[model samples]
Target: MTPEPNQLLRPSLYVGALVLPLLMSTSALAQSAGGDWSYKIAPYFWGTGLSGTVATSPALPPADVDASFGDIWDNLDFAAMVVGHANNGRFGFSGDLQYFKLGNSGPTPGPAYSSVDVAITNKIYSLNAEYLLKTSSTSEVWGSIGARYWSVDAGLNFSAGTSPAASARSKNTWVDPMIGVRGRTELSGDLYLVGWAYAGGFGVGSDSSFDLFGALGYQFTPTTSGIIGYRWLSVDREDGSFQYDVEMEGLMAGVSFNF
Candidate 1:
C-alpha cells in the first residue's frame, strides 16, 4: 500500500515550523548587539554526486540509487545556496542554506513495474556559533557548536504494464547537534588552505551525520576571494516509517566577499 502525499510531507512541515523561528530570532539578536560587526557572504556551486538508499515503510524495500554529477545536473530543476558569516571580536555566528529539486526516470525491479520516475526535494540548513581559539597573520582556528536541519521529500511513480500508474511518496526531517572545527592556513602568497569537519546525531535526531570539506582559496582582492574544494557528507537516519542512508561527495567552487 502506498502512502498519501501529505503523510510523507508532514514531518518536514513540522520541523520547518519548529526551526525557522529560531533562525529568525537569532538574526534579530545579532542585529541588536551594539558592536562593529564584520560580515561575509559566499555563494558557491557544488557538483555533488549522490549515492544512497531510500526506503519507505516496511512494505517497500530500500532502493539503491547512483547518480553522477552530470546526471544530477540534467535532472536538477531548481537549486539555491547561500552561506553567511558575522563576527564581533572572537565571537561569531555563521549560517548556510541549501535547497534543491530534481527528478529522474529509470527502470525498477519486479514484474509489476515497467518504468519508475522519482522526484526529490532536499533542504539543509545549518547555524553555528564559534569562538576563535587561535589567530595569526597566517592562520586561524575556531571551535564551533551548531545544529543542522535536514528535510527531504521524495515522490515515486511506477508504471505497470496494463495497469494504472502507482505512486508513493515520503518526507522526513530531523535536526542534529554538531561540534566541529574550522581553520585556515596560508600556503603561499595570496593562497590559503581551508578545512572544516563536523559530526553529530548520537541517536538524538538521526543515528549519525558527518560533514567534511577542504578547499584551496586565493585572494583576488582585499575583500574578495575564489575557492575550489572537495567535500564529503553522509547521513544515516531511521525515524519511524522513513529510512535513509545516503552519502554525497564532489567538487565545488565559489566566490566570497568579506566586508
Candidate 2:
C-alpha cells in the first residue's frame, strides 16, 4: 500500500496528543503537592524569517534562501505554537511545541525553466527537567536539560516548457540532547524581565541547533500576564542526501496564564 502524502506528520501529531494531556495534568499534580507548586501556560506568535540553504540532491548545489516574515506569512499553510511550565519547590518541568507548513513558488533562473514550487512541513517538540539554583521574591535562576525532537518533510516540483513536471521529496527526523538556562527578575511591582537560551547537538542527531529568547512581561492580574519578546533559532543538519541549514529570528508576543 502506498502511504499518504501527509503521513510524515503523524508521529508528531500522536506524540503531541499524548504530551498535551500530561501538561494539563501537571497543574493538578502541582496544586495537590502544596503551595509550592505552580503551573503556567502560554500561547505565542513568532514572526520568523527563514535564511539558509537547502539541497534536494547531491548533484545540485544547495539553494540560498532569504525569506522575510512577510514571505513566510504569504507561504504559510498552517501553524501552531504553545508552551507550558510547572514547578514544585526547586524541581520543575517545561514543554514546548511548534509545527508549521509552508509553500512557495518562484520562476526558474533561465529561459529554459518555467517555475519551481516548494512545500515544507516542520514539527519540533522540546521537554526538559529543570532545577533552580537561586529563588527569591524578586529574582530566580535555573538550568534545564532535555530532548528535542525534530521532523521535517520537504518537496519540490517544477515544469519547464512543454516537458512533463518533475518532482522530488525528502524527509528527515531526529532527536537531540538539549541543555539550557532561564531566569526572571522583577523590574517593578508588576513588571519583570525574563530570558532563556539553549543548545543541542554534538555530532548527534542534527549537526547543531540553538535558541535564544528574551521578554518583558507585565502582570495584568495575579494569574495572568502579557509578554513581548524577541527570539532567534538556528539549525544545521546533514543526513545522506538530505541537507538543511537554516536560521529564524523575530519579535514575539504572548499571554500567559498561571494556575
Find the candidate with the highest lDDT and give its number: 2
Top TM-score model: 2
Which residue runs of candidate 1 sit more than 4 Å off their true CA positions?
1-32, 105-115, 161-165
Model 1 C-alpha lDDT per residue in residues 1-259, reported as the tens digit of each score: 1234664365345444644665566557767987877777777767666667766656554555666665756554544456777778999988877765556666666666677676767888898999999999889998889999999887777777555667778999889998998989998799999889899888898899998999999999999999999878889998776777877767778898887
What shift in Å separates residue 11 of candidate 1 from its native position after superposition?
Answer: 21
Instruction: Give the Cα lDDT of each candidate.
Output: 0.76, 0.78
> Which residue pairs of candidate 2 clash?
none
Q: Go through the candidates in order and give the C-alpha RMSD of each one to the true structure.
A: 6.2, 5.1
The residue pairs that clash in candidate 1, if any, are none
The runs of at least 3 residues in candidate 2 whose Cα sits more than 4 Å from the true structure, single-residue gaps closed, are: 1-19, 27-35, 59-61, 69-72, 104-115, 159-165
